[model samples]
Target: MMMKKTVCMGLILCGMAFGTTAQTRGSLGQSDPKAKVVLDNVSKKFKSLKSVIANFVLKVEGANNSVSDSKKGSVYLKGAKYKVVMGDQEIISDNKTSWTYAKDVNEVTINNVDQSGNSMTPAKIFTNFYDKDFLYRLNGETTEKGKVLQNIELTPTDKSKTFFKVLVDVDKKNQTLARMKVFEKNGNRYTYEISSFTPNGAVTDDMFTFDAKKHPGVEVVDLR
Candidate 1:
């Protein structure tokens, strides 16, 4: 249960790695044009890449501004396929089937990918998700680590969503996503900082799947 929750959160962070180019819905009357321009540039940049490999740091904070957990992870994305590795957990999907692997137990769970809901996926990172799901505005700029970052604040359109707001920091010079912070209603905050990103990385379809033959005595739980 804990691992599943962690993977879900990690996927959400990964989904926001690239902005979208879709048109904003009419409900987003407050959306900022300037922010959309920045996001559009990011979208165009990511769309030109054939694949991406990114290293990131995830930080979870409690309501009292105390850090609860921190983990470093890497994600590989190519078209509709993705693989995420963090500590002892890995989530991989090939746009059809999904696998969740736990290294500590040497167990892997398999299931079908459900694209009917608002569930975030690495492929959605390139879709126009923000235009339909969020109302955003430009929140000014700040200098971080000697780089000028344009801050954009986003509010979800659906009131029932678990998260209330998301803060995105875009690298002004490169027009790439730099950081993202999600604020939940329960006072839990999740932050993802992109440490490094490599576009057009060498990746193959087999890398997105698990091979039990490689792991001796591995257990497979087919939940699909």
Candidate 2:
């Protein structure tokens, strides 16, 4: 359960790595002007902020539209580093190495970061996902609790991709991301909603790395 949840979280950051190569993506068209404008604004917002901390709810649904499970978690993202906490599991990475801690099992796994640039991390997405893999367009607008939201649809350029589409909701007034929904070809839907967002939160470097010494009696499996 912990591993699956961590992978789901990682998928959001590594969407650009799936399926096709950059050369094969040449035939794709430019992003729709409207969508480009909105995403550009969002990228700028992320750049101006020092860091980000958010609480989120993740919902997983089956092909029949029935909820398989739901979990609440918090994430801290700062540049190429991030830490995710859900239930008794935590995934921490510093763009160089990663650590997965499963408290219930009293175990930790360590591995080196995949430096191939084939995968996009959360930090990479915040900085520049608009330039690759997807062609996006405005999906119209809707109001939530009286707040206006601009919905944008992103279609993967490669039809062979596991997930065909992604929907992003941006707050029109604040120019911040509100929610994201990913639809998978396997009939699984992943919905991530941000319940709280704090920009420029105080973050330290050590927070992104894990130290097994801090947790005595934990088994360490080093895969590096």
Candidate 3:
């Protein structure tokens, strides 16, 4: 039938397009030795911390090169648990159950925390994404706002990923992550800048869990 032929042709064309894109993406391998040293130091430092508190600014640039207003936010991390406060939404996770609280709607959506190795949560990126699933290269060092930052480019091993490249800027002086930028194949760029960081910050277990009883008349949507 003509309809069946058309569908077959569409599938073939889609496959061709995907093949072309995959050829242009970077493949995973060992990182540059210089870059490895920096990353290893950072990973060790992060693992040694009991908890961390930090303030960040997020900037999203669209495909057309139009940049959105930078949004300021805060993050609290203790092991796999984390609490992210940005805009009117507060995301809290105890590494088991995750709750997304929308202040505007006075409602919360509960979902199970993704335990997959490939899950790309903010906490995962801040602590462990570079350690696996990526091959990195030292893009050399750059001075940003008068601070020397070591720039590293990470290419995902999985070519099917929406984000093909990630750029991480580490503060050489303190050996801490200062900024990260994710480049998507769709031409969108996400930039996260860490303004301040405090390791071993005071955090209670209760801070990572959401109690609906505290919020009067709050609606809960259990998706888990």
Give model 2's TM-score versus the native structure. 0.89
Task: State the C-alpha lDDT per candidate.
Answer: 0.78, 0.79, 0.73
Error of 3 at 38 (Å): 1.1
Best by TM-score: 2
Q: Write the per-residue lDDT of candidate 1 for residues 1-224, one digit (tens) a residue.
A: 54554564455534432223234466556789999898888888888889999888888888987658888988899887889888888888888888888888888888898766455675565445576677889999999899999999988776666677899899999887888888888898888888998889999999888888988998888989
Candidate 2, residue 209: lDDT: 91
Residues 57-86, candidate 3, lDDT per residue (tens digit)? 877777888756577788888988888887
Task: Point out the worst 10-residue segment of candidate 3 by lDDT.
Answer: 12-21
For every candidate, C-alpha RMSD to the true structure in Å: 3.4, 2.3, 9.6
Listed in order, each prediction's TM-score against the native is 0.88, 0.89, 0.83
Q: Count the backbone clashes (under 3 Å) in each candidate.
A: 0, 0, 0
Positional deviation of residue 174's Cα in model 3 after best superposition, in angstroms: 1.4
Q: Tell me which of candidates 1 and 3 scores higher on TM-score.
A: 1
On lDDT, who's better, 1 or 2? Answer: 2
Per-residue lDDT of model 2, residues 1-224, tens digit only: 45654665565446424432443555776678898899888888987887998788888888987658888988889887898888878889999998888888888888898887766666655555755667889989999988899999988877877888889898888788888888888788888787888898888989999988899998888889
